[model samples]
Target: MAIALSQLIAETDQLLDAARFNDYCPNGLQVEGRPYVSKIVSGVTASQALVDAAIEAEADVLLVHHGYFWKGENPCVTGMKQRRLKALLDNDISLVAYHLPLDVHAELGNNVQLAKRLGWSIEGGLEADNPRSVGLVGAPAQVQTPQELAAQLALALGREPLLIAGSQPVRRLAWCTGAAQGYIDKALAAGVDAFITGEVSEPTVHFARENDITFIAAGHHATERYGVQALGEYLARHFAIAHEFIDCANPV
Candidate 1:
């Protein structure tokens, strides 16, 4: 069964509460395509590769967490940007994106889904003051040493996390998916034994070492892969539509 593109966007906007968050990119329906959609391809980013994959899948719509026209980015459609946009326009495939909205969705968010995969119990927000903190503080199923936590991350994400050692066992931890190394301070403020995020910065090592907190840098793509898939599955189940998650890997 085909669902109207407008209807799909409306349902997603409502479900993700897209308008409520201050996001760097547009939250819903970045590009309009055919009115009805029976097939959808979802991914973490809307790169040219993902667009090509969606086309290969005969997808009518491409749903993603990262999309075009980021705030403060050069607006001129040239080079890679031109090629990507042209691909979508030529194929008449809709582009829908939700950045912060996808990350922080309590039930289907990336962090929560990652937690489910690792058997973690979410405790609270890493930033207590921010009502929509994407980073989350949580407890592991069992207390683990820094080394053990690193191994768990490696096993779960299928990649070795850059582990910054801490002083003690990790009973409680905090995590955010996709380039959230900056949230480490908030995790430190929470005084969790460990903090896990997608990307790592030079200062992250210094901070982790000084504060004696374990820091884990799981791959950004691996960490963020879940939310879009969860959202795609939900859209599929809700509308009885055909949806496939296209994984376009990025090591960074």
Candidate 2:
């Protein structure tokens, strides 16, 4: 069985609305493909390699977090952008993306998925004021040392997570999935012992050192890979479609 692109778009749109996020780009069906989709391929970013892989797999829809047409990004389809777009268009591969919405969704979000993997039960979002905040605040199923937590993350993500353990065990934790160092203050204010995100900035090192909270920089792509994968699986199960994840390694 296969779902039409229009039906998929409707499902995605409903999910985005329920998540309540201010998205960076359009959330669904960014590129059009065939009317019916049996195979859905998902990833963190819509890079050239991912596009090529999706085309090779004959994916009807390519889902991702970081799609084209970012606010400050060059609008012109040139160089890498042109190649990626051409690959999708030439193959008639529909591009479906959900950025902040995917990160903030309570059930299918990156933070929630990561928390579930690590045996954490989410208490609330890190930002109490902003209901749509991407980071989450939670307590682990059982208290574990910072080192133990880092080890768990490494095992789960298949990469060594950079840990800056402070003075205590981690019970209360805050987390955002990718390139979210700027939210350190929000996590700190939530009074979490540990804060985790992907891609630490230079200032993040200093902030973690001085803030008296443990910080972990897990790989951006690795941390984010789960949410979209979970979403793809959900789509597959519900619509009776086939789903696969195209993993593209990214250190940052």
Candidate 3:
């Protein structure tokens, strides 16, 4: 059954509560399409391929992590941004996105979902006092070697994770689902033996090596595809809407 665009927005806002996040981009509908939505497309980013998929499916609404109007991005909307938005506008497809909110949701969040898939029992947020922390701390069923854990991550993510091995076995682990190399310090403070994030910066290599923490650089796009897919499935079942996660492969 198709839901109205307004109702979809209301449901999405209620599910994610975008107001909670201090994100780079606006968290809700960035573009308006038809008043009613039957098919909803979910993806990691609203890239050209994803937009094309949405168009091919004739989806009414496109939900994603990376949407337009990023903080500090050129506001001109003249090139790639223009083309992306133009595709949505030209196809009359609505675009809705949730950034940190999607990453931080306790159950359906990216970090939480990854933890679950890896048999990690979450203890708390990596940020401690901050409730909106995107990174998470957790324990595996038992202590595993850094190599074992890295293998698990690699198998699950379908990519060989870049591992910076520490001397000790992994007991406590912290992870963030996307490009969160900056949270290395937070993980270190949390006393986790290993820190896993999607992408790694150059400095992160040195930090992990110097700090005696195992750092894993899993593919950013690979690590994030699950949360939104799970969310789409949940929303489809709960809200009785057609949902599909259109993955646009990104190596970085």
Instruction: List where candidate 1 sits over 4 angstroms from the true fold.
Output: none
lDDT (Cα, tens digit) per residue for candidate 3, span 112-158: 88888889999998989988878989898899999999999889888
For residues 1-252, could you state the per-residue lDDT of candidate 2 as single tens digits? 888889988987796673455567777778888898999999999988899889889899999988878877788988988888888888889998988888888888888898888888889878898888789898878898989989998999889999888889998999999989888888898999999999888898889889888999998888898889889999999899899998998877
Pairs of residues clashing in candidate 1: none
RMSD for all candidates, in order, please.
Answer: 0.8, 1.4, 1.1
Q: After superposition, how far is residue 26 of candidate 3 from its true place, in Å?
A: 0.1
Candidate 2's C-alpha lDDT? 0.87
Query: With candidate 1 superimposed using the best TM-score fit, by how many Å does residue 154's alpha carbon deviate from the native?
Result: 1.1
lDDT of 3 at 187: 92
Please tell me which model should have the higher TM-score, number 1 or number 2: 1
Clashes counted in candidate 1 amount to: 0
In candidate 1, what are the lDDT values of residues 129-226, reduced to their tens digit? 88898989899999999999889989988888899989989999999999999989888889899999899999999999999999999989999999
* Residue ranges of candidate 2 with Cα displaced over 4 Å: 18-20
Q: Report the candidate with higher lDDT, 2 versus 3.
A: 3
User: Global CA lDDT of candidate 3, please?
Assistant: 0.88
